[model samples]
Target: MKKRKIFFVTGARSEYDIMHPVLEQLQDSGEIDLQLVVTGAHLSETFGKTVRNIERDGFKIADRIYNLLSTEDKVGRIAGLGSQVTALAHTFNREKPDIIVVVGDREEAISVSLTAAYLSIPVAHLAGGDIANDGNIDNSVRYAATKFAHIHFTFLEQHAQVLKMLGEDEYRIFNTGNPALDKFIHCPRMEKKAVQPLIEFNIQDEPYIVLIQHPIITEVENAGDQIKETLEAVIASGLKCFVNYPNSDAGNFAIIENINAYATKYPDVFHLFKNLDRVNYINLLRYASCLIGNSSSGILEAPSIGLPVVNIGSRQRDRYSAGNVIYTGYDREEITAAIKKSVFDEKYRAEVKAIRNPYGNGDSASRISDVLKTIALDDKLIYKNITYKVF
Candidate 1:
């Protein structure tokens, strides 16, 4: 019997981490020939050249697509998408994999799904049907991927129901939960003493905050001002902040500029990083007093460890969150008060600790792996139909 060829596309550190567990499962299945197509920020030095992280994890890269543009604005993002579509179409044509797997709503997801649809290859989309009406282009991109995708693996039952409403066939949709949590649950926790050397901060001696705010595409011009508000709030709270750089999105240059200025101005309390490995990042979340930012980690992964999150602004506005998040706008005072409540309120902390993560049971990788191995590859899977039903 010939092994099934499964090709996975990863564009950013966050997307790669989310898909790592499933990638591991597929590689270990013995029934799969896994191909990894690395692209976007993974190949860019400005984003830490995270392709090395994948290589360090010991996965053989099938190909690398260097499609990230030097410009950091809306025009650059669209141009990068066009580059990805062109490059990925040629790659998929040459490789001819049994299926193409993509995660989340980034440009990579749409690029791969769109290319695979044109090539008559099945595309499996993870984290589809999850709503984040954050006024960013992400929501539209995610929903568009859903229409092109042949199989849907969502993070929640609610998200699966969303696929149903979107006219996706129920049999093709699986509520496999978030694969990122699988890694979070299984990765060995790093002690504060060990974490100190990695972060260069004495987390054991004082409470610290993990900050990861990304720029919203719709509000590109104000990205610098928006991050300044977050910086002011975090600084005013007087907590040592371990800040992460934003993703490779439009307006990220402004956000990075503000973050750099703040870090230089307050060297003692502000620390900035391009990226951190998954284990170190998870452990940082484990020991932080609170997480302050608009990154989806605040919405998806933070709750599992009972970390209090002060989610500032609309990047994650309508996303479903566990009981651990406190939503606030871009106002400095409002963000400061939320940070205070998250970090200092013992009662709120206790309540947050007691709330279970609604995402999944950390077995999503196994479930997704099983489907990929067993699902039949035929015309039925390639040709999709809208499953409209009377409600």
Candidate 2:
């Protein structure tokens, strides 16, 4: 049998982590020729040189393209996406792989998905049908990726149903949960000796919180004000706040700067980790007083571990949540109040710990790999007809 060529695209650190298992599986498979196309923050000098992380994980790079914006602004983001689409169209046509596998909702993936769809490549999208952030652009991009994609791995069965209702053929959408879940199933319990040196802290001595909030790229003007209000609330909450690095997006420069400045002023209460491996981040959440902010992981991943989450603002306005989550508006008082409750309210903490996650039971990689193996590759790709019935 002739080997079918598969081109997997990686745009962000987290996406790379989620897809790592599939990459390895495909590498070992005799029937699939895996070609990895890496771009976006990986190609950029900033963002910890993401490509290094990929290489360290033992994947050979087939193609490397740069689509980083010159400035972190609206104009820069638009220019960068346009750059990605143009470059990816050229590369995808050159490789002409049998499948284009995409994951998550970064703008880089959006650009690459458009390029693949135009070139009529069979796209396999992972983690579709979930919603998060009014201004994050993920909801629209994820929905758009689903239509062009020939295969999908939603985080749950209901999400798969939603995709089918959106006109996707039931066969094309699979309920594999989020591949990110695979990371948890393999997580080695962190020892104090190993973790203490990994993060610089007064953390072992007192309570600490893990926070991740990216720019609401869809809304440019509120970036600074939103971070400011959130910072004020974090400080007022009276707990040691450990903020992680934000994603590289337009308006993120200001947010990063503000966080750094805030850290310098209140070194004891404010802690910042420039980068964390996914395992460390998970372990930290396990011990954190509360996981706060708009990161999708807080909503989807934290609940599985029964971690308390204080989700804020319009950033995560539409995502599904479990009992572990407590939301608040962008108001500083509300944010502060929510944080205080997560730390001090005994009943609320107990309730959060008892809620089970609706996301997955951790077999996403195998399920996703199976779907890719079975999908039909046709010459003409179009949306399949859906059967709707009157109730």
lDDT winner: 1
lDDT (tens digit, per residue) of candidate 2 on 304-369: 777888887777776777878788877899998998888889998889888877877677777777
Clashes of each: 0, 1
Per-residue lDDT for 154 in model 1? 94
Candidate 1 structure quality by residue, lDDT tens digits, 1-391: 8889999999999999999999999887777899899999999988899999999987878899988998865888889899889999999999899999999999998999999999999999999998977778999999999999999999999999999999998888999899999999788987789989998876788899999998888988888899999999988898899999899898889888888998899999899889899999998889999999888998898888889999988888889989799999999999999999999999999999887888977999999999998998989888888888667
Positional deviation of residue 293's Cα in model 2 after best superposition, in angstroms: 1.4
Candidate 2: residue 41 Cα off by (Å): 1.7
Model 2, global lDDT: 0.78
**Candidate 2 runs further than 4 Å off:** 28-31, 132-136, 379-391
What lDDT does candidate 1 reach at residue 135?
76
